[model samples]
Target: MRERSVEHEGRPADPDKRTLRLQLLTVRNRLTADDIEEAGAALAGWALKLPELARARTVAAYVSVGSEPATRALLDALHARGVRVLLPALLPDQDLDWGAYAGEGSLTQVRHAGRMTLREPAGDRLGPQAVTGADVVLLPGLAVDAHGMRLGRGGGSYDRVLARLERADAHPALVVLLYDSEVVERLPAQEHDRPVHAVVTPSGVRRFRTG
Candidate 1:
C-alpha cells in the first residue's frame, strides 16, 4: 500500500505542550471517514506484522473515539488471533482499570462528565494491576516525538499506567498507534514522561529505545 507522508506543518516543539497537542488534535479532527477507514485498515495490517503482538498472550489496548485513528480494526484483529485483549475502564480518579475484550459487543459506551466518551468493557472489572501481565500495550496518542515520547490527550491516565508498570517492574513492549503525519520532530518533555518501545503508523512500524 502506498503511504501518505503529509508532514503536519507548524509542528514545533513548543514548550507549552498544550498548544502542540491542540494543533495536532485540530488536524485530526478534520479527517474524513474515508481517511480514517483507510488509515485504520493500513494500521491494522502494519501492526499485525509485529512479532510482539503476534506472540503476546495478553495485550493491553484501548478503543479510539471520534476523529482519532480508529482502533476497532486492531482490537478485533487481536481478539480474533486468540490473544487475551484487555481494554481499559476509567476510574473516578482518572487511573485505568482493565477488562477483557471478548468482541465488539463486549464494550459499552461510557460517558465521563468532562471527558470524551469511551467504549469500555461490559464484563467484569480487572484491577489496574492487571496491566502488569500484558506482553504488549497499545497506547492511544495524538502524536509521538522522534524520541518516542508520546503526546497523549493530556488526561494523564496513561501516565499513571506507565508509572504503575514501572513500579511493578513490568516490561511490556509499549506501542503507540498514530497517523503518519502525527509522528513529529519533537515533543515538549515532562518530568513524569515515559518513552515507548515502538510506534505503529499508517505508513510503517518504528522501533525506539525505552529505558
Candidate 2:
C-alpha cells in the first residue's frame, strides 16, 4: 500500500488512507439521485458566488463518467454562460491529456485509466500549454481543508499538473472540489504538497491565502 502523504494535526492520516479513499468512493455511490442533484446545485451556486469564476473564459472540469460526483450540471452552467470547457483525458504514466469539451454529445469513451471517460481526442496535447488558456481549474480531490490543502487519490496526477501550472506561471484560481464536511480547519502537508487557492464545497466556497 502507498504510505500516507498527508498528516492532519499531530496525527498522520490513518494507515488505511487508500482504503478510506475507496470507502469514500463507496459512500459516493450510496448518494441518491436527488442527493446528487442537490449537491450539484449547491456546488454550482457556490461556483457562481466567486466573482472571478463568473468571469472566466475557459475552464477545466471533469466529466462524470459514472458514479462519481456529477459535474455535468456545473459544466452545462459554464457553457450556458458562454465559457469554454475542457476535460482531462486520462493518459498513461499518470499524465493528463486535455481537450475541448464542446458539450454532451462531443464526448466518447475509451479505456485509459482502468476507468471510463467522457473525452475527445487530444491531438498535439501539451499539459502546460493547455492550462495556459484556462481562467479557472476545478480539481478533483479526496478531501480538502479550510486552508485549501487537497488530498487527491494519491496518483500524483494533480500534483504534476499543478506543478506544470506553476512552471508556466499560471495562477488560474486553483479550486478543489469536496463535500461540505470535508473542509476542515487543517490537513497534513508535506514538502512536495501543493496548496490550492480555494476550495468548493456543497455548502459554499472558501478562499485560502498564504500560510
Candidate 3:
C-alpha cells in the first residue's frame, strides 16, 4: 500500500457522510434483496474467472458486515476454491496486519478505534517483504471510477500501504469492490492517489489498465 499525500482532503465532513448515507439508502431501496443476491453470484463468477484470483498464493480481502456484499462473495469463493486468504487485522498503531482466515466460524467482532473488525489473530506481524509476494489485493472503498481512482473512508491507511507497494515494485494489482451504483463516471482526484487496476461490482467486473 502507498502512503497518502497531503492528507485526504476530499472526504466530506461528518455531515457529508450522513448525507451520503441517506443517498446510499435510497439507492439500496432501488435494489431488491434478490437483486443483490444475484449480483453477488455474478460478482463471484467474474472474480473466479480472473487468472490472478485463480492463481493467487495469497489473497487479501475485507470483512464486510452490513452494506459490503463484495467481500462476502469473494471470501466464500476463495475459501471454496482452496485459495489462501489473509484478512485485515487492526493494530494499535493504526496500521493493518495480515492474518490467515480459518473459516467463517473463526471470526469474532472486536472493537478498535471506535470501529468493529472481525478478529483473527495473526501469529506475527507481516512486513512489507512478506506482502510483496501477494498475487492480488481486494481493496475496499465507497466508490471507484473506470480509471480506478477510489474514494475511501478518509483514513488513507490503504493509500499508505499501496504507496509502499509501488516503491517495492512487488505491488499486487488492486481491485476495488463497490456496489453497482457506487461506480461513478468520475471522482475528485489528487496526485498522491493511486488508481485501482479493477473495479468489481455485483453485476460484473471491469478492468482498468494503467500506464
Candidates in descending lDDT order: 1, 2, 3
- lDDT (tens digit, per residue) of candidate 2 on 1-211: 0111333324344455556577666877777888877787788888877877788999877765444455778888888888888777665556676877666776676654444444443444445368667899888776776667777766666666777887888888888877776676666566668878888778877888845
For every model shown, the clashing-pair count is: 0, 1, 12
lDDT digits (tens) for residues 89-129 of candidate 1: 88876778899999978999987766667789999998999
How big is the positional error of residue 18 in model 3, measured in Å on the Cα after superposition?
A: 9.8
Runs off by more than 4 Å, candidate 3? 1-38, 117-129
Comparing 1 with 2 on TM-score, the higher-scoring candidate is: 1
For candidate 3, give the lDDT of residue 39: 68
Evaluate model 1: give its TM-score.
0.91
RMSD vs true structure, all candidates: 6.5, 5.0, 4.3
What lDDT score goes with residue 90 in model 3? Answer: 59
Clashing pairs in 2: 7-188
Worst ten in a row by lDDT for model 2: 1-10
Model 1 CA RMSD to the hidden true structure, in angstroms? 6.5
